[model samples]
Target: MNDMRMSPNLALNQLVAQRRAAGESLVHLGFGESRLPPFAPLMERLAAGATRNAYGPVAGSPEVRAAVAGYFGRRNIPTGADQIVVAPGSKPLLMALGLVVPGDVILPRPAWNTYAPQARLAGKHPIAVAIPEECGGVPDPAALRESITAARVLGRDPRILILTLPDNPTGTLAPPALIRELCAIAEEEGLLIVSDEIYRDVVHDPATEFLSPAEVAPASTVVVTGLSKSLALGGWRIGAARFPHGPWGEWIRSGVVSVASEVWSTLAAPMQSVAEYAFGEPEDIRERLRASARLHGAVAREVHRITIAAGARCRPPTGAFYVYPDFEPVRAELGKYEVTDSPTLARRMLDLGIVVLAGHLLGDEGEALRFKCATSMLYGETVEEQQLALDAPDPLALAHVRSLLERVEEGFMRLVP
Candidate 1:
């Protein structure tokens, strides 16, 4: 507990900022920050709510919770105000779940970095199960059952299973069939599933189908999401969660509120105002969401093309602004650069003026030659430039965006060659 390193993505973002401040020009492909500016309506709502200063309920203001409940209701998940909890960010809600949920946690092998750390903070073992070959987020059904049995055999209690929809590090959504299969396994094993759907609204294609674990195994699944990734509200720190509707869900919700009372007290008043309006998903807000998704998908696909052309086996970006490219194919050629594993490979990229989060930082094997490239950071350095990209019919056609993509391409070409 005394010596765990800071989350790698945040650390790398700070490092890149410091280096850029010192006049070093580098392509930043490390952080998943949506480079878009906030919609005027969201900021207006925050300002309007500024006069309300008193602390509210431990869960959230009833109004905001109702709005969030409606947000889920429209998505076909019947949610109630009592089942919603607003927090500073979904990260803390997830951590609180970790603290409250009993037994060890199960996680995808290369999952969002925080899941494993949060589980450890809760004094539980994090069992790593391999993800399916076709997509990330959900653990492979067969591997999950085996992992659970093996952990129990070894005297570890595997209880909670955390999943990511449109997973971080690898921006691919798990197919509906696969999600159902995994949900069935959870039902059979009585595992509590925490589905992290932060990137749900950022799907590249409007026609892409998404299936929530809650829709399948509603009795035991808790869905968590935040405005940070989808609505570009990272600094404002607005997040919400929908608990299953039952006594079991209520018990977990109660424990979380207790944790929240001791920790956050309540979501900030101004943020509640913002969350209420944002989670309502009004017509104007929906348009903004669609535009943002288009921009993310455009830039990410270009980056994917660059990675693929550079001879790396990269997945096509489907939901988020990321591509997890495995460099194992070029390991032999990379020996000259002293790049043998994730860290060394990432170090070589940074040395060559590009920043990438090594796969190991996301809990992949340290020896695996892989890394994550966040395509979102390629948007631009300034508000005006980002807005231009957002409004453009073809974001990559814009010079500022194209130049950054070119830099990534050049960087990868040099690394692979």
Candidate 2:
């Protein structure tokens, strides 16, 4: 699908690779990968099941499905084996959902880039709505209503809204009240809400509540999550979706399965084994999630402080290991360097041996001097350092990460000045 949109993260990595090839000593803040170590048990499980050769069911293995159901149950969201669809990644599952659901897609302007393109590939228009000031994922309720009315007048049928909690670039989780308000609007508009809660488990504050759209509007909302971010399992390519229970749920599930049969067919046997273990909701997995969340939160906040101190405008990070920084505060200085746009600022960072994704890559205005900094990549060159930081009484005090933070702070200072 040449006309389809490519993922901005992937594109950023490509740029990083090109810069490295040119011998630039770049600080990679581009891709948002969890540089944490994977749970040893999951690796063991995969190794034990690596010998299976035959393809399993198109939907997924029964054991994995059951585990996913139990996993959701642990979160107070009731689900069953039939309600889950394990896929290569949540990205494909989302693409399939766009195809299954009718009408145009509604997305927050600065969102995960794939949402809009996936909708377009499914032959639906993608309508961008402005997000609320406090959150960067779900569209503001007022903007949502106005956008729908405007689209309807223009003869567009807006039927789906994609919400990313603890968003990719912004790293701010939508408040439960905000989710409830958006859910109410979705109900009124007869919209199907796709809650991309991939980063939900990575909440920095244990007390910050996360209310799934399905929890607020189960009748029409679907939840999508995977182990990629939280578990540093991006390479494993295991993800799942949870649909509401009903006739429509069955239809959606069937559609996803049908799409799976034509595409990936089934997740690898080894990855399926890992998925079963991860989705089983074991004590070990719980501990792993908690540790990962703590590490991500700690590192992301450090980057947030650095960027703000450098005179960049940004929101306080709530979850995920990212910070969206707007360099508009230093617009005058940036213009002096001929860096008046996101792309220009991105190149300038690269020239300074720093790498970050421009805000326009996440569907923001192209001319805005903004970008997403992924703090997870700052984990030192070895597992010992990461583990030590994770186990340290005060991770921020750990030398390795603190050094990286210092580098970032210095880099931003140089850029802005």
Among the numbered candidates, top TM-score falls to 1
lDDT of each: 0.90, 0.87
Angstrom error of the Cα, residue 13, model 1: value is: 2.2
Report clash pairs, candidate 1.
none
lDDT of 2 by residue, 245-291 (tens): 99988888899888889989998888989999888868898888888
| C-alpha RMSD (angstroms) for model 1 | 1.0
- For model 2, the stretches where C-alpha displacement exceeds 4 angstroms are 1-6
Worst 10 residues of 2 by lDDT: 1-10
Alpha carbon lDDT of residue 248, candidate 2? Answer: 87
108: Cα error in model 2, Å: 1.0
